[model samples]
Target: MKNQSNMPLYQLFVHPKDLRELKKDIWDDDPVPAVMKVNQKRLDIDIAYRGSHIRDFKKKSYHISFYQPKTFRGAREIHLNAEYKDPSMMRNKLSLDFFSELGTLSPKAEFVFLKVNGKNEGVYLELESVDEFYLAKRKLADGAVFYAVDDDANFSLMSDLERETKTSLEHGYEKKTGTEEDDFYLQDMIFKINTVPKAQFKSEVTKHMDIDKYLRWLAGIVFTSNYDGFVHNYALYRNSETGLFEVIPWDYDATWGRDIHGERMAADYVRIQGFNTLTARILDEPDFRRSYKHLLEETLQSLFTIEYMKPKIMAMYEQIRPFVLMDPYKKNDIERFDREPDVICEYIIKRADYLKSELDLLS
Candidate 1:
């Protein structure tokens, strides 16, 4: 593997037989045993192909879980995203960092190069998985984490698939950690979101969710124009101390002036008021709507600007440019990749202008 760049290198040693089995069924969720060497230290791990459609790409993403008594930077699990559709390969990291800066809980990410059996796999984004270790790292109290696996996680009484009433409120979520009682906490939140009386909705829903945190997360998605983020590309954490559910961003590579297919998207693609049942209900109340408008206005003035974001974008772009140029998978799009910093900056300018005009509509 090339070492011209300063990005950390992770080497995975998978037995030929295990590699074949893992390749035999790309859709399989079960992990195959593998060994990872980093900083000259080898650790036993279980690795599985991750993602819904990206699994079919020539370059694949991976989910790695460390064995007992072994941890990677205090994390038992981590996600290595190929970011195949994104030429810049920095949107996910940028968006998450932006959320964290906005005082919202978001996953921590970094750029790293990977090699399998000593063959270069190019640049991959290493993301901190939102699980038990995540809570422990932040010194957050014990809680339940649920992943919104599909569009059905829309927090609606209606199903996104059938367009009819859902059979279960928990249709689209996968319980990551928590007791059986935790399930009821999520179900009850959904039930109240859809069935609560509008006059009493604000008082009731606020009791079950951290409205301020949710609105901040909503602003992140809106400012970044992540169309898919409102519905399913997030995780719900039920804080035991506060007993409120909070949203955390996930799978945001399709954002920042690009759609899921990596095509350029208009700056105004996602509206100031994002989609989904929970967001709609939250914004329906006068006080909450005002709060959201204020949040968006504040972010627009301070954080969501070319002045604030360009340096960060350029820093990541320059740091990864050398490595991306050497990547066989991204070689064809080096020219496009080189132009991504400008593309993202232009998007931020236009998106900010558009949101400023729409802020009045919230009132």
Candidate 2:
């Protein structure tokens, strides 16, 4: 196969001993020493395999952090997703870009070819790490950020695993940057979501969250049909200036007409209303419900159309096709990869229609 890809290349050089130790336990959270060579510059980094089930894959995702105060592209850390299950390998980037276009806070992403020890590791999605740097880069207010690690981050009083009342309200969140007081703030918000009276829920909840931003994020998940996204697969950033929690999307490779396993998903798999305690409470109020409905309708008519999305989808597909053809890991899915653009465009049409039909429920 001819090598015709123009994507940026990242080279990782790890000591043989460290490489062995890193591979010995893919499930470990510890980072091994490595040197990353990019654009003819070498920097010391700590590398670790990231993600839950993805660690079990032959080609694994990686999390890279600088040794100290060093930064890469204005980011202290970065996540390189293998996107092994996504035949298209562009869904994560596309979904995140969509969120940004919708005026929602989302991590930026791009395609990059990865090589380890001079051996080709194939195409990877390089995602901006949502941390203090993320806020600084965007010139956003200083805030506390937390990752929804699992389903327990569902903004509920109950545990997702045992379905019992959770001992701690912060069961599923891992604080990325925040003080102890931030934890209390999140707990208080969750408590209000589940316990606030119906008449006062809207007013009280709005005080803790940016309802418009949350609604836009919810619409992105619903349109993309990421079923697991409702409960987790997101980050929460509490803006210090406004004192309101806002959502940032993460790990969206399981979207764009496919389930986490990369199987075909129906357009209506996720409802227009979305899920979770916080979402439900927001939609319960008549004014908020109307705002969400209007937002969804506008999105359907504008951004979610084939006319609007096909060009973007095809651009991504074409850019990666040359690389995909040469990718060793994607050989089995070459045909499927070629078909993904059309598949995703068709999904956009079907999903838009489904949501249009279900819009009455919101009314």
The TM-score values for the models, in the order shown, are 0.98, 0.98
Candidate 2 accuracy as TM-score = 0.98
What CA RMSD would you report for each candidate? 1.3, 1.6
In the range 1-363, model 2's lDDT, one tens digit per residue, is 124756988999999999999999998999999999888888899999999999998888999998754997799999999999998999999999999999899999999888899888888999999999999999999999999999999999999887999999999999999889999999999998899889888789888999899999999999898888988899999999999999999999999899899999988888888988878878888898999999998998899999999999989988888777657798667898989998898899899889999999988
Model 2, position 67, has a per-residue lDDT of: 74
lDDT of each: 0.92, 0.91
Candidate 1, poorest ten consecutive residues by summed lDDT: 1-10
Q: List the residue pairs that clash in candidate 1.
A: none
Predicted candidate 1 versus true structure: per-residue lDDT over 21-57, tens digit per residue: 9999999999999999899888999999999999999
lDDT of 1 at 116: 93
Best by lDDT: 1
